[model samples]
Target: MGAFTRPFFIGFRRINTYSLHSMRQFVLFIVLITGLVTGKSAYAQWEFYGAGGVRYATTEEIDTNGKPLVKEHGFLPGLEFKANYRRGDWLVTLGGEIYGGNLVYDGQTQSGTTFSTDTRTRQFRMTTEVGRYVSDAVLLLAGTEWDYWKRDILGRGTTLGMEEEYNSWRFLAGAQTRVLQASWSDIYLTGLLVVSSPEHLEVNFDNQVFDQANLSTKAAIGARFALEVRPKAYSNVSVESDFEWMRIGRSGDAILSKGGSPVGTVAQPEHVRKAIGIKIKYRF
Candidate 1:
């Protein structure tokens, strides 16, 4: 509840601009599904929850001109919403999240001059999954995930600012296991593996352009766990603490361009992202 709150609000506000009509349709679809389920059964299995968390991206080092370089680290504040529906042994899950942060980049010039710039970063992800319970406490799922990222670098002196954007997709498979269950509390652990591909990646350096040339598919690995406590019977209210970790692959190719000609290529560093926080949820 400091400077990060500003970006948290900004991220949610920008969601419509990011997906527009698609998001509206998605929300309506979920509403319709919820209505149908409630109308059909009194013991309906449906859950809607929202969470807020803090996240950190691993440090990265990148090269620049004249033996100069930069190292970046990102601290993000995030919010997420998830919906789940279960009938018999089959379950469907839909979720989305937004993260916004300032990426601190420390740079060193060839002449040994050092400086830092705070680059703004905004990211969003959507996920859908279909799963079946293999046992009372174990579930296996497969899903598709999509991510969008944007970064803005502030100009310093004669250096022109840059805006970078990326769209990515992943096919994922995962399993969830309940580690502990009590009358009023529960614990769950989940692990996932994904094959990720970049749909688009580009950089606009004050109008000069750099685009992805030949991108490579990469693997992403993730895990998350949650502990929840319910306060009363027949009540959907609960408080939970969630922990998650993800290791993502490289940032793909960035082909430098000048006057409509390819000049050089840029190398990007890999990323490891992690988040942990407490959230309150209500199941319906």
Candidate 2:
């Protein structure tokens, strides 16, 4: 065992976070070795596991139908690596993970105007935590980390253009406990509370009426959770799944938009997302 053992974890959505992707690689590595060693390619004493994420966002358009004008989706790709070290009641977990993907949206309109845009999105994150043993099978963990991100928006036709940078101070505190220890595998559940600050240093479009830029920098608090199964002691394979909800800085009127005349009464409602995703990890 190297560090934090329970596969891996993830947190918050709206803005992309890097935890979930790292773990999937670890989970898959376990399965490949198990299949070769056991003669069966199916799940064995060692196994692999993961999940995928799908996100949706509502637009700023208002309607006589009382419906927001548009909606869109964001899909991200991520992976994880794990090395856990456990001594009876205490242990340390260290790992590195990366999330790479594109941010895309399809504008919904009350009228005939439909819009779409795509931007480059990427995040690199890593963490380390120390765990204090509570019981022979339980551990409480706490730690901190660093997260770096970059998002670029390129307008196609009538939409907006945005280029933003997000670098955050990441603080994590959490716990994991043994749920069941069976002959085949060990099951555990983990939860983490994360506090971070994301800054947007550049704005190219007006947040309100300008067709170029809109949206603000944000610092927020969020949470992450995961459930994992370890097939055997020192086994290379495992099964894990996770969920994360994140609130990035909100969308506010930019410098350019603030002074512009209200364009035909434009309105923006709150934007929220519930993302569920899956992935697989493989270790060499």
RMSD of each: 7.1, 12.3
Which tens-of-lDDT digit does each residue in 103-154 have in candidate 2? 5655532244555565566665566678888877777888776665555555
Worst 10 contiguous positions by lDDT, candidate 1:
1-10
Q: Write the per-residue lDDT of candidate 1 for residues 90-160, one digit (tens) a residue.
A: 99998887778888766543334564566787778888999999999999989998877676665555344
Give lDDT per model, in order.
Answer: 0.60, 0.51
Which residue segments of model 1 deviate by more than 4 Å? 1-45, 62-71, 107-113, 207-235, 239-254
Which candidate has the top score in TM-score?
Answer: 1
lDDT of 2 at 218: 56
- Displacement of residue 211 (Cα, Å) in model 2 is 14
TM-score of each: 0.70, 0.59
Error of 1 at 232 (Å): 5.4
lDDT score for candidate 2 against the true structure: 0.51
